[model samples]
Target: MPSAISRFAKFAAIAALTSATVFASLDDAEARRAGSSGFGSRGTRTFQAPPVTSTAPAPAAPIERSMTPRPQTTAPATAQQPFGAQRPGLFGGFGRSMIGGLIAGGLLGMLLGHGFGGGFGFLGMLLQIALIGGAVMLAMRYFANRRQPSYGAGGQGGSFSRSNSMSPANNSSFQIPAIGSGAGSRASSRGNRPSDEIGLAQADLDQFEELLTDVQTAYGAEDYATLRRLTTPEAMSYLAEELGENATNGVRNRVSDVKLLQGDIAEAWREDGQEYATLAMRYSSIDAMVERDSGRVVSGDDRRPSESIEVWTFVRKSGADWKLAAIQGSEQRAA
Candidate 1:
């Protein structure tokens, strides 16, 4: 058999090599991630998928990553906490009295040298007490979790009246001087269309178009400041992570000729004083990745522009300009 010390050294070596390999794999994965992958916060609708639009006939991809905290669902309210909430205080009432009696009996046996606590002494008594207390706590916790209600298909926030949400008071419209606004282009009947509580105007749509160009160019140029200004903090963080990965891979993304072909509102809603709009857009651009130092194209055609269809969710609070909050790729090709 190999000596114990030699075996330990070999094990350590193997562990170190494995750790290095894992880290290298992670770095490569990050590099390939490029940018957001159907990720980012969309307020209460973070987990919900946006509706498909004419520009993007297919459904939007599910959000794979997000900063939005998952909403905590609770059981229906009753007289107490929830479904028969009778949480006893981990060995409370008569249980406490029984524990006290046991401790007293154990101490008495120890005084008589009758092998109290398995003949281990006071330390053993302490261990016994700890073990019992831990068990009681665990049992209480398990019951509590069992009683906790699981989220339904849509949760509380998911089910809302489309007619009520898209009422005249909440109707948002815009007029695009260039290609005509897509207002009233929505499906005649609202099935799962997200509703906006607050209405947005023509100027907001115009600005959204402007932001589309600005954000794309800024990301291509790796301009962190511009990106920060145009996107929400959470969205900016994801963009920065992508940029860092590109830098690590010694390459950079370049984009130009950003022209919006068509776009339509997928959903618009307001919550907690913030306005949100998810828009499906089709645009063309010359997007390429190139070596950082030499600026030689590595992935995309520099001259030939390609089309992309994506859903972008924008958010704004009070009187602030709309900022990009999320990005999702379309799921299916347009028929």
Candidate 2:
């Protein structure tokens, strides 16, 4: 029985050792892919949104500006008619006179014993009074016209002159300032103020390419100081965590021969006093992992280089140096 127990203890020890080695290998592989270009969290997206601003784009592109001009127009002024220019009709001035004459005629007819009704009733009396009033009005109008001076053709000429005096001028001029000119002035002012605009110069673009290489070199060499300087606080934390995991598993990732194959701007914009740029970069590198003590190859190929495409986002304040803010993979791959 004692011999049997000794054999079981030996078997258990071998099993435990094998499990530890397997776990260590798995941890190293995970650490290798942890902070790779196609791995990790993409930082906060401040510009891309459902809530749009003046400078935001309908579709993603480089170098978007908000200084477009608006159209200009002028509405014509309308002419108003003079109050006294409206002429009166023939009965206009004799309304009260006609009313008085009708009443007087009715009363006279009643006193003559031919009351409101005779051969005709109240309607016949009203009709007779109306005819008498109309004749009297016509005689008065004729006398009044006879008293006034006659000017014939010359009177018609005077009427035209009065009409000309009453109507307003037809050719009035109005000035509407051009909106395009104002927009040009605003654009010039913005050009003079560097802070208002966020444009990437050729030199700025070169720096981005240089950083792509420098960051990879520093990370491979386990240079935390260089990583901190080249990346944002959030990105630094992620890189640090990955490196810590690799160290704990007694392994290290070695990246070399890093080269940018192709690159282009995906989108760039300025917001909240900061400039942000997202770039799609295709690169090739020799990426591999090795054990800490014996330096045995644990994962990946050291001699064979691999190519990958990734989207990287960088951000900086006005007149400040750019730093890596986020990273995202083009294709999802299992670790």
Candidate 3:
């Protein structure tokens, strides 16, 4: 039989081992090949789609999991017609009715012995048709010609003269502005704004790169303390949940040798007293999952490295160090 002191020693040893495992076990989010899905928050823009960059030209996959409420975005209706819609003809209902009425009245004049100005013979019928057609053609041409916008001597045209139109000229109620015209003044204003509004210094970019390595390192090691230091509360919570789920499944993930192959700024802005920047990065790493107890290979190869393109969002208060706010798998299917 074991002595009470010996049992106490063995139990203490087991507890220490258990504590060590707890610290090292939850590397799921960092160690596994994070799927081509996005999650977490990106400040006020969490639900908004990130802009496309050269490194990530294809549309990014929508964030699958997020703390921010997805905003309802209604697409603006277009002025263009749908495909294959037939336009109304020039000589439509009103024109046809006008021509028909002229013919009827001319024949009635003949029946009533008016004889189209007292001619009444075969030549009179032929004369009536020719006169009516010539009058109609002249009237239509004159009416159409009168609606033209007057031009200055310098050839610049003024606004069109107002008049009652049987049908709108060209059947258009509004003129579509040209591509380079001032129609998009509001959108162009944004494009014209200086990029310095975000004020990302070279130092800031360096910090972002440093954060990338630190975050992945802390995540792979299951170092919650480091993770908490490097990530926002909301992001840490999501990562913690992912690791817990993996731990519950009795698997441990490991990632190493992270290398940033390409990186570019996706977007940047300031709001709510915090500045945010989303960066698209292509990186490669050795990621694998193994059984927690026996350490048997369960998924992923430890010796082989895999590539992933992702958008990482970092947020910080004015003059504060940047912290990871979100990670989204980018549009890797284009590759």
All predictions: root-mean-square deviation over Cα? 14.6, 42.5, 32.4
lDDT of 3 by residue, 215-248 (tens): 7767667789999999999889877876786688
Candidate 1 per-residue lDDT, tens place, 1-335, comes to 33664454344434433433343243235324433246689988897767655556555666667877876757564535644333544344565456545645554554454433466744565476456546644654555445333211111111110001110121222323222223333532545543444555677777878888899889878889999999988888877877887788888778787766666677778888888988776666677777899999876666776656677899989788899998876654322
Error of 3 at 222 (Å): 0.9
Off by over 4 Å in 1: 1-36, 72-190, 194-196, 333-335
Per TM-score, the best of the predicted structures is 1
Q: Which stretches of candidate 3 lie over 4 Å from their true place?
A: 1-35, 72-196, 333-335
The C-alpha TM-scores of every prediction are 0.58, 0.43, 0.53
RMSD of 1: 14.6
Q: What ranking emerges by TM-score with the best candidate at the front?
A: 1, 3, 2
